[model samples]
Target: MAAGAAPVTTESDCRCDVMAVTDRDCAGVTACPGDRGLLLVAPGGYRGRVRDPNLTRSAAGQLSPERRATDLRRLRTERFDVLIIGGGVTGAGAALDAASRGLKVALVEARDYAAGTSSRSSKLIHGGLRYLEQLEFHLVHEALTERGLLATRLAPHLVRPVPILVPLPAGESLRDLPARAFRRAYYGAGVATYDAFAGVFGGGRGMPLHRHLSREGARRIFPSLRADALAGAIRYYDGQVDDARLVVTLARTAASLGATVVTSTRAVGLIRQAREVTGVRVRDLEAAPGSPDAEFEVHARVVIGATGVWSDDMSRMLNDVGLRPGIRVRASKGVHLVVPRSAITGETGLILRTASSVLFVIPWGGHWIIGTTDTDWRLDRSHPAASARDIQYLLDQVNTVLDRPLTTADIEGVYAGLRPLLAGEADSTSKLSREHAVFEPMLGLLLVAGGKYTTYRVMASDVVDRAARRLGGVRPSRTADLPLLGADGYAAMWRDRADLARRHGVPVGVVEHLLERYGTLTRELLALIDADPLQASPLAGAPEYLAAEVTYAARAEGALHLEDVLTRRTRISFETTHRGLESAGHTAELMGAVLGWDAATREREVAHYRARVEAERESQLMPDDATADAARLGAPDVRGFAADRGVDGDSVELPTSSR
Candidate 1:
């Protein structure tokens, strides 16, 4: 194969026979070679034509208001084979996995999808290099494999390769030369092992191999590095993603595969008959403030909990039935600070070793992300506030090698997320395992927790495999070859970006921005802009975002609240210095037009969003988690739904007419 050329596969290159035989043994299907793998057989065992993966393109996958309403109705009326709690990446992946395998699946989330840890990650789909030092080869391999898949086959639109530079300090003394050489050798060996694993297991290959650079070479690549701070640097590739977008894409993909995805609905308790768990009792948190809560039941053959940090809460709900969950979740909070890209002036991302955890100075669009502090957190899971101490710690660590130090004034945004590390004998949160564990505490109940973001698909597949044993006749997970909603024709769309920009009468940069965010779906956004040319203009306050995106968030994405659109969907909230307050009203107006919100309701949404931003600011100023949690909780939740930390029994019922 030539450089950058697509590979051609012939009949001999097909692994269908091997995959079909393996799937048959796992799924207990005795059908012959005719009825296996991607090739579907007729009723009489005659081999049918091969199915075209790209044949279907339906707007049914779009999470518009109509779809949400229809899905909610389906949730209340239908019984599914699998009921997945939490619409985070793991649950979304599980829904996709189960649904793609020809099983009925439904996923319900308490808040907006990816509102938790999924959206707040460092945005890297890296094979854990630190894990290799910990002798966790399996984890590194699994994460690398998933990373390759995301960057190439699965979500090429969302995931891309990011080159990182690890600096090595210059040796001044003659005595220090051997020590420096040893350090370099040690780091090089580890990185080589990392690359080897990626090469062997990574299915979709795109990234370049690791390279050693001289100090001058390193400085040439990253001129911002402080002089005399490094002897040289090692460059390596890892995958990066729009974490929140990946979650929503997963949910949308799952929805496209016939899974009913409902957000803004809380799972109050497990519906149990005698000793076996069967379904969930849920409450619509979108109920009018001061109105009675409307509750309903979603029955399923099996319930899978993928609620990340809130796993313990879900487990506690099952405890009421006298079924004690063996796995316990220990929450660890990780915080990241975002500054403008001009602050660093680096071509590649920097990976600096910190005393406690690794610091990543990642390059985002027009901004750089510097993070993170890993500490045990027992505060409110919903809002894990980052304190001044945490901010100072990150700044102090990153400043060690920066030519220009970043202060609080330089920060554009700050976000905090809690990792659901499964409790083990490890003393520190950093020492805890990233490997996930699945448990069946009851007959129809399943719980999956602990894994890192990179291995969510694997975790999802494992959980569904367990569920398949319970619900017989369900095929194995087919998500390995599945492309996310916007991934199928992304490469082609990217190649024709210039033409798209010319056709749409927008700048090439604008088209490129849309492509990076929406991939091939950029065409749909362009269509919206074409219908109303004004929609092509930048937002009133947040010029980085187009007005059309705000409307699209509500119309096509499942953004019920203004905060959802600003904060997660477009990232305007944290990306702006005003924390999206300036654009709040205008954005809300766009959303209101789609959601049919009255003027009063639009005003209220804007007010609520500003209050939320103020609360977040106040929380960041607090000294500790306790005070921060109190400050954050001071802001009213959009739907007035309080955290049901220890609630028991069925959800409180409101009038059915409230629906």
Candidate 2:
């Protein structure tokens, strides 16, 4: 390994020529990569051609289709020091950590990156405040430390502080005065302790201290709050992010550090040499079942499973390979609904304590995210369905404080994700502690599961540290201080955003949006637009996203299907009033151009996405989890294998029933 030189991806083979951002440091900064004419890089850098038509130059962290193809070849032939399954936050983090430590690492995901629980989180990066009530001080402290790191250092561009209010309800009469005083004292003390923990841990909270406001003051800040709802409110700050975007950034960061990151690839069976795991037999979900290239074995010194709820399924794979699983994971469903920001006339987000758990009303761009219910889920883990009852429960809970009650018509989007809680004896899923566990049941396999999103980097560090112990001579983790792909020199980039917008002939507001979504990587999109100025035009249906963004997702963000682009890469699926139906065809077209899809393939992609939206709508109408799950399954998966792994097909099918 050499300083300022790209890490070679595979052993004894120059499969890819991954050039670091720039050959020379520019004015002692990483943001300006030498006039920004990137040389596209990949596993097999390039074929016989001087330049690739699809990809322009060698850019570190770009997961172009060519890179995936080359990486797949490497996965089938090369040996790695560490192999990580699951492309969620933790798995991606692990890959980055291991790769930066100078180890050969490969990561495979069953679906798109952040396709499961990682993308559907409440979008908050905070130490669990309620955990303080549970006397889980260590957990809170650890999580707070990580939060500070993400907000201030690790991913300052992506993670930002958001103000939240805890409304103090007014008493009905003098008889209830004691309850009011008690509520204020208890909550105030808990919040003060939370601040103290943050102040003592890491560097600091990285946001303003909590503030107590009078009833009139709170009402003035939140005009839509019912006059009789609260006596006052306590406002504090927590970090928030586009969860799916964060995961994508992590994967890109891992790739930039020489980790082989692939999605739409699943672990089907464990490759074992009698009681010891040697590698994994993986199924390329993108490949047709039973095809010659459908499945391949990836060899590694140590194998780790970071699958969340899918942790139990890894146990099944172990059973097939004559190994017993050591980790037990329970799935808890969390549902969130998105509505226009105008639905709630509030300047700050709200946190409400419910009978069983806490609920958050988070402020998204031009939208409000209200959620979530904590209940055990036994149905489909891949597509956890949110039922009508669940939606009603959230509405009822939030309506207690809002001047105007919300209805189904107010919802623009709904999503449900499963939380992997470490199996415990607690009767309710809400009672289960948000703690993670790691296991090495077999000689070469490591299993890490069950933790809150806030501590993903910590979890990644722990799992990799264990794996390093098995593979001697590995270096310590370097992720705590290391920034993600777009993090370094972000402040300078943001400071010159106006000049950047002017140089690119784009609006300052547009530049601001790109900076928030992509820090220094915004240059990539600007480059794409420069190549084809037409791509600068916003989508007809979803004006918030430029056409270039869709192409960028396909070319550099590892988006294989239409749903991946709509739902995760850009979030147009949930942000739009039509739930992305109005934008599906155009999105597919833009993605098709990069993915090399013909007319028929593009049509199929559009059809599949539309059917998925409808199925989600129908499922939301269902009264119970079972019915909702069944309704949601009516739409076949864009990745055929995601619907049912046993299904025999290579095509991302669009059935007439769903259409």
Candidate 3:
């Protein structure tokens, strides 16, 4: 593996080029000397011809309709050692871990990967500083260790340390000087402890401990704060990551390690004989919209239910034993609102204590991600639309500290997600535990429920470690030390990023963005540009992303549907001004070519995606959950792709019921 070189194609003798063909161009196909001997064809679109990873030249991209069919056929024929049920961070982590450990692995998600709570998180990969306040030393230590790994060793490209300022209230309380000193001394000790634990993974020298600022200094740093509110603040560092990209990369890494990763595949039932669980009954979601009916069972040696909120549903499939005792999965709704960066101008993020919980105004791509109301949610789990109350809660909290208040109009995007808290019989959902639980709820069914986003890897490693024992032949989990696909030499890559950007004729900012998301794999994306110079151009509607990424997502990253490409594969839904409506058609057009969709299919994808946006808007308009669910139902299936899988070929003429 030479630096700046491309991946070699599979041998022609054993490999087949998986490029699709349109009726428009048939003469473009050419057999090339590479790993997969099948002829590659030039793909049409904004980018230059997709590059052959092995050949390094712009060869036709594989993922043609015919190749997709063959790939599906091969997937159906194969048996994986471990079948992971969710495509959240935990499940994705399990897939990567299992594959790296030499186990045959397959990960199935009913929706796009990380389409649930994973993408809708606070976007920080930090050790919970609040946990330290609660005296959960062990949890803090463990999280700090993972955070260090993510920042330095594992995903330095994706995760970087962000500084946060926690402002103390203005006052004439006890000795101001001593209290500031005490707070700094106390919090500093905790950060130092975190740093010490971080050293075990790789030193956390880059992450600084807490430092106290004077009232004047605090005001200088965050001018929006009420100057009279007069106390100082403490600043500390924590790693932030694009949660969606982490999961996407994890899935890709698993695939690179030989895991069968499928999106839009629903696990309808648990395949079982007598009391023991075996495989799963899955329906292919990528089929035509109207088609439905049959479900096929995918048999596997072990099943891991990393379904999170839907864990109960997976548990019920295997009878009462499948559900663990005292396993109360409560849904706590956390909503975030994206506002323009101009709303809060500061070098660092602001964290203040609200009456209910802490408020975070974190910075994202050219915008501020202000969030999170932790309230009870007894609504539809799938599409947790942000309610008026959810939005109001955030606005009120953010408005409390800002000089210029923000209204509903300032909101660029609003999203709501359910946090699977370990349910307790408390009157309030917030009182439930964020700590996760893994249970052998039933024979052959392993369920992981109730965890936060930061600890997904630990949860995943634990679940896979357990499943390994059941499968008989097991290898120790290697994900702890394993860098994801794009992680190798990322630091060095970052150093040479400017030169690479110049060579590729892309902006330095674009190169930085690519490095942040893909790490060393930026080279892979760059190869797409290298073969055909046109690929270097940014997407027409969504300039934030290069056009080649959309292609790379489908071919290399396993995006099965349009929504997978827009929503999870890229943060187009939340990051864009129109929630991806303007870009949906273009994206669909790009992906539909690869996915084998005709013009009609392309239209359907765009129409369905637009309806989904409209429905989400309508849902947010409703007063409550019931009304929201009804209004949301008015929209088309955004996940219609998942509904199409496993339809029977034979239309069995069953005897009509004679009443």
Candidate 4:
């Protein structure tokens, strides 16, 4: 094959041609054999349809079966300037930041990218308004700056300004009126300061500042709020992003800049010598028959641990000889409820203050996402289930202002996640600070924890900066100006989306969705659907996503399992009415074919998911963390991970935490 030409349509294709694209999985897109009758995928993008020409079939970090046989392969066979564990935003950002600066980088995640807290967020890319109350001005300012960067320069397609209204009760005390005014002024000042701060950091000036609204004005903007409930309100502008897409874009950007990223691969053991850490031992969880069972070890000079909640384990494994670093992580469980948008008929979202912290009723694609109760969590860090009590707590809080209350029947989905905080014993986890802490625990081991979603880039940059000294003076962080894949030239893509939609026979809205999720890379998914237009139809039960997205996730993004596709990649688990239970089988079937799973394997996946939901339902019925943890343990592993996979279930490793 020619240098820039696409690779052959078989597994035994030329290695050099495959290397032309970064080692990311391009499965169906680049690997499938297409019908050969002059199928023009995209007029100027790709010429032929023998395969998807977007390099979607090349799986990263999966160079060859031989290269993947042992752990520490990079440490012994080759050297990487930086080795990043955890494929969440922090790790993805680290890879992008390091590789963009001419550092040889490799990032590995025990699960799929963003499988942890990254994918399970409330999906807002906003400056923390609550931080202003805590007087964390610097953190708020930094977050606002990043929000602007993502909205305009970095990922305009993914991040957009969402209008949020904070209501004030009508029958409040005279003193309460003054207090609300004071809060408005303080919040306004902070927002102005944020706007000015963005100017200094070279961020965009597109979004407006915070505005105070009268009772009538507030009612006009948000009709769902009871007319008598509000004395006045405040309207603020913030960024909202597809959290999973952001993580994938970061990983793609890193791969584009020459970093090797792999998913469905686990870091089972750390490769180390006396008093110094070197690399990792990884095993492919879905290996084919006759595949070697031993771990693959990759050597690297510096290993920065970006594994958020798993930081303690990574740190402990790195240092078996020296005094271990203090375990400073506290896991807080946050639960969210998804209801149909008809429940709240309004334009702007509501951010209601509650005794527990705050309740956000945000609009998400024809649905209202009301959530987030923060409490102590002591079990099941991987899949924090939403129990009956958690659901009731959210419903009771949200019912305070709603004209008509919501019940279980109105619920489309419920989800829970564990947030990693600096270890503390506060009475309420909601009171914990959103600030981050980075520690160099021992030689070659950097552990980072205690940051919120908005500041993941800063957290990653700081971690890499600390480990840079060990890399013999690496370059300073340049992630601020760097745009993730699909971010660059997004504005132009948005302008031409209508034409692209017409050309591909897809709806204009579908084009918009694609641009929002993948920016210019939407063409890649469109091209795949163009080959087999049936794939272009949305998934049966979950109409929010196209069937092509599942294939794209497995091929382009590193989705190796059904759970990775349904839960993280497309949010089928949290967006559907049944929490994806009704759609799980079809999803498994589609994902199974792509991943090479037989009927037995598919049945196991379905059973595991069902048990998980049941366990979560049981856990939510409990009042406290201990009982919830115990109930949640009723379900076994959903992925049925092999013995060689990272975690061993000899004993349950539930996170014990306070506040």
TM-score per model over all chains: 0.90, 0.90, 0.84, 0.84
lDDT of 1 by residue, 1-659 (tens): 23332232342222121121111122322222221123333232222212122323325468898888878888888788899998888988898888777667888888888888988999999998989989999999999999988999988989999999989988788998898898799899999999888888999565789999988999998988987889899999999898988888888877765678988888777788998888998887776655553678999999998887777666666665676765688989999999988888888999998877689999998899988888999877777888888888999999999888889999889999888899989888989999999988888988899898999999999999999999886667778888888887789999998998999999999998888888877887998999999888899778988998988888877999988988889887778788898898888888988999999999999889888889889988888878887888877778656543344344332111000
Model 3, span 1-659: residue lDDT tens: 22333333443221121221222333444434532233243333111122234432112222234433543554477666688888888888877777666566777777777877888888888777777777777777778777877877777888888888877665466667687567666766766666666665434544766677887888787787777664677777888888888887787666554466776677766777777777787766666655553245677778887876666555544444444452457778888999878777777888777876788989887889998888877666667777666777789888877878889888878777778787777787656666788788667777777766777888888888888788764657667677776677788989998999999888888889888888877887888888877667777668888878887787667676777777877878877668888888778777876676799878888888888888878777777767876776676566553112122243211010000
lDDT of each: 0.80, 0.82, 0.70, 0.70
What tens digits encode model 4's per-residue C-alpha lDDT throughout 198-270? 5565277546766878888987877767877777887876777778878877877776555667655666666
- Once model 4 is optimally superposed onto the true structure by TM-score, how far is the C-alpha of residue 268 displaced, in angstroms? 3.2
Off by over 4 Å in 2: 1-58, 288-290, 320-324, 642-659
**Clash number for each model:** 0, 8, 15, 31
Best candidate according to lDDT: 2
Q: Write the per-residue lDDT of candidate 2 for residues 1-659, one digit (tens) a residue.
A: 22243433332333222222222322221111111122222232230111122232226678999989988998998898899988888888888888777677899887889988899999999998999989998899999999999988889989999999999999999998899889888889988888888888956568789988889998888888888999888998899999999999988887765678888887777788978999988878788667999888999999988888877666655565565767788889999999999899989999998999999999999999999999999887778899999999999999999999999899999999989899989999999978888898788988899889989998999999999898876667778777777777789999999999999999999999998998888998999888999989998689988998999999999999999988999888888779899988898889888888999999999889889999999999999999999999989888775454322353221110100
